[model samples]
Target: MQQHNDTIDSAASADEPDQIHEPRLWRDKGWTARVIKNEDGEGWAVEMIRDGSAEPALVGPWTMGRNKVDPKPLDATAHQTLVKTASEVIRRHEQQLHAQLNKEVSIDFGDDVVSVRLTITPDEFEPFGTLIALNPLGDVLATTNVRPDFRLTRESAGRWAADGFGKIR
Candidate 1:
């Protein structure tokens, strides 16, 4: 839960000064932490993300962060590990998308062709909107959506156009 930019002790109810043994890498405005009280009045470790991004940033099996054996709250070590893991996860996702775009899927829209060439775009959110399509001779024929019509064959540009490829959005 987002408790306004703070990572609280999962096992401790009161904010008894966070025995900060080490510094955290993700100490940003978008990150937070909270202590989750379990049914047995136990505490569970959980992180919060209020950046309004795709996923909620949470940490731990919650109560598992606390040792049934130790009952200690989350620490610097665990938080650092969490940061690394989350960063790697997002990096892998972008890498996979780059691989997909660069893999080159040829679209046969009759005389027209579409190629999903990978472009080094600015580091930003997920890329969307229509991208241009160029031919082997570098000629512009039609502007289709990022996705091609699966039914359109290279030999059927006229048909694809008639069915609506270059129609102005």
Candidate 2:
């Protein structure tokens, strides 16, 4: 039933304070688990927030206590499970973002297979993309800047190579 008001101000450092283990809050291993009142309904909810992150990585309903009026106290097993799940959520998000920003395709051009890759850079004012073509031996044949919204597909890559790797229109 200890109390702690530690705020997530920055990434976990080597000199950070010792770990905290409370009934409703637990902080350790670069993650914090907090059981709070559920805003959507009557039951409680638990949130897992990683250090230095402004938002919770995962939030879900918490089990009710024996009396059915209070929330079950946070424990080590529960905290570990929450940490694993929240870490997975963050990992999936990163993978999805990477997939969205990068695309690749291989197509038969002339007598050889050419690998084409498009990487998008999301900038606030001037988002752009790079289109690269490589020979079967992984030698770069051409590279050019293109609109960020450019879509790289088998057909488009074939057309680009068929056009002699010129500017995409």
Question: Highest TM-score among the candidates is held by which one?
Answer: 2
Question: For each predicted model, how many residue pairs clash, with residues at least 3 apart or on different chains?
Answer: 10, 0
lDDT of 2 by residue, 97-149 (tens): 99999999999887988899999999999999999999999999999899999
lDDT of 1 by residue, 45-64 (tens): 45544345655445454544
Q: Residue 64, candidate 2: how far off, in angstroms?
A: 0.8
Candidate 1 residues lying further than 4 Å off, grouped into runs, are: 1-30, 38-43, 50-55, 63-70, 89-104, 108-113, 116-131, 137-140, 144-165
Best by lDDT: 2
User: What is the overall TM-score of model 2 with all chains considered together?
Assistant: 0.87
RMSD values for the candidates in order, in angstroms, are: 11.0, 6.2
